[model samples]
Target: MNELFTRIVSGVIYAAAIILALWSGKLATNILFIIFGLICLFELQNLLNFKNYVSYFVFPIALIFFNYFNVNDEITFLFIIACLFVKLLLLRDLFSLKGRNAFRQKKHLITLMYIVPSMVFLTLIPKLYPDYNTYILLYVFILMWINDSFAFLIGKHFGKQKLFAKISPKKTVEGFLAGFTFTIIGGILISYFNQTLSFYNWVVVGILVSVFGNLGDLVQSKFKRKALVKDSGKIMPGHGGVFDRMDSIIFSSTFVFGFLFVINHVS
Candidate 1:
């Protein structure tokens, strides 16, 4: 079928980009991040109707974070918090609109708040784990992939209990538990082989990813529902869009970056 072929082509493109960014240094990685950030931002703006001011701020902020100069994790974290404060202050009047229009206009920025920073985190992975960043990133991606793939296959075959029927009907409790299990197994297996990461750390990594990744998925799902759109974009065939594709990785990558940062510093 055309749909199946489209999905295959899209998958190949997606995989190639991810691998390229992962293997490449911070500069190349940030290039990819900026591109993705722009794409996601545009989609959010169109889909959710964010104000121009918010988009204006997020654009330059994302650039600064991706810069070579912004390598410090602490600085980046503070920058993210500062952005939140800016949003709170700048949008106070909009927030007080007390009607659907305000939230509607702000929805785009809200989504950017999560999407942009996560992309930066992806860019930061290389910076934080300078020596073994690629391998560590590999570990994170593998677990996320395993979690999603297994969840979809297992859930389709035997998905009885809806995990969040209100938000994502296709998701089921059985699928989620299966995803959690596979993520743990994948994490341990990958991290053990790498030697740079410990087994206990891998376990914690697995737990954090499963928790955060699903939350990210749910967050996107809520956004999609609120925005009244099924897919974020039409670029990918079966994947829907960038956000649709990177939904889980967004949160998982951030967690992995932070986790490795702590470990890399402590050890």
Candidate 2:
């Protein structure tokens, strides 16, 4: 019952924050993500046991500049490429026999390379979209939530095969497919209200979130397994930590940003 109450309260707060931020416009959204980035950084640092105040100070300053400056597409593209490369390296480490030590040895570098750029791209979404549409950002979050919620429900009831037992034992193939299916549905529904993105584009977004979002969760699970902790932090009751909550968004935001970047350039 206590756990149930915590989940409900946390869900309400999380939903409210996302909706309010979306309704408040671009600046508020930017500020909210900046705060999210910092909290995630803090949680990650704790998980990795790497105590560095540099990121704490640098992230906000860098975010402020990125938000204020008229950053060119080339730079944004380069950042996305860097983020992808780092993610690939992380994936490689995840699969390797020595994955655990490799991650610990390079925690700081990974934090700088992976976490920083992901947050930057996440903050860039609203700015990149037409009219600085906050709905685009909101749509991403909504799809993520929908995918996560349904995946758990379907997986708990009917999951048979493990998706990646080593990294995340609880995840199952059935759950993944269920999440992917519903995310596509959620995306199409969101498209009806948000005409800025076509139905096809929203479906594409759904695919990205369903695939990469799960990967993100697994990536964090690896981190937690290594750290021998259940969650990253206790910032959000029943939700683990800021890092736990934002892992999917952090991991998947780059792809979303990349898509938007290409769309903007071609159109």
Candidate 3:
């Protein structure tokens, strides 16, 4: 009971912070995410056993460069490509018995590639339209929250078959399906209310976010397994750490931004 109360309190506080940051506009959002990205990097550094602290310095610089410099679309495209490639490799490593051993030698590069660019793309999401629209980014997060919430609630009460027993023993197939279903519904409702995107596009976005978000959770779980730690850190009492909270968004951001970017250009 106390655990549940703690989770609820921390979760509300975290959500409030994000909402306020988003509502405040560009600079506030960037500052909030930069702080989040740094915390995530710190947790990931511990998970990956990073001894060097260069990433602590490199993260904000890279984020600021990509975010504020008004770099051309070509550069952004290349950066997205690089993030996708590295993420795909991480996905492959997630399922492999060897795990992330292959990339252990390039720890710093992997750290920079994995965390920094994803956050950059996430911020770019709001700017995908002609103007900076916070609604789109907020909706993306809304769908993620919906998916995650249903996954947990449904999983806890009715979960039977394990989704990834080796990596995340608690996750069930039933939970994933529930999350996916509700996310699509949430997308449709958001479309009705916000009209940021067409119904079809929002549906597609829901699918992408749900599928990738869950995968992100799994990926983080694999990292925790490798690190032999239960939670990423003690930052959030019941929720673990900032990385623990942001893993789904971190993993899904690139794909969501890419999809929106392509559609925005094509449309």
Candidate 4:
């Protein structure tokens, strides 16, 4: 009961902070992410046991360049492509037997290419449409939170068949489906209220969030398993670390940004 209370309090505070930042406007959101990105890097650095000091610089630089400045669409597209490629590679590594070994070899590259850009793209999501609407980003986080909450609750009570016992023993197939189903529902509801995206697009976003968000959590679990650590950090009382909390969003942001971009520009 005490542990559950701690989780609820900490989760509420964390969500409040993010909502405040989003409502505060672009600079606040960017600053919040920079701090978050740095903390995530620090946590991952400990996990990977890499001593490269330069890894810290990659995130702020890339984030400021890609976001603060008005870079051409061509350049932005190329950068997004690079980040997507590395993200897919990370996804592929998750399924391989030698995943840890592969991650160990490319720790610095992963930091630069994967971890940094993912967070950067998250900030860009709200700006995908004309004018910077915080509601879009807020809704994204809400969907993720819903998915996560349902996954945990349903997994703990009704879970039977393990989704991946090796990496995350607690996760189950039932939980995953529950999270996905509810996320689509969340997307529909948000679409009616927000009008940022049509019902169909929001549903697509919900599917992306549910699928990739779970994969993100699994990937982070894989990282922790490789590091032999139970949690990323003790920053949040109940929630492991900033990385632990943001893992799903961080991993899924790029894909969400890409989809938004295509809808905004191509469609």
Candidate 1: RMSD to truth: 4.7
lDDT of 2 by residue, 1-267 (tens): 899799879978978987898799877877887888888988898889888778877778767777788877678778789889878777777777753565688877777877788887877788876677777888899999999989988998999999999889999999999999999999999989988888898999999998899989988998899889999999899998889988988899888888877987787
Candidate 3: residue 257 Cα off by (Å): 0.5
TM-score of 3: 0.96
Which model is ahead, 2 or 3, in terms of TM-score? Answer: 3
lDDT of each: 0.71, 0.85, 0.89, 0.88
State the displacement of the C-alpha of residue 220, model 3, in Å, after optimal TM-score superposition. Answer: 0.3
Clashes of each: 0, 0, 0, 0
The ten-residue window of minimal lDDT in model 3 covers 97-106
Best by lDDT: 3
The parts of candidate 3 lying over 4 Å away from their true place are 97-100
Q: TM-scores for all candidates? A: 0.82, 0.95, 0.96, 0.97
User: Candidate 4 at 211: error in angstroms?
Assistant: 0.5
The residue pairs found clashing in candidate 1 are none
**3 versus 4: better TM-score goes to:** 4
Residue 202 alpha-carbon offset, candidate 4, angstroms: 0.4
**Better lDDT candidate (1, 4):** 4
The predicted structure with the larger TM-score, 1 or 2, is 2
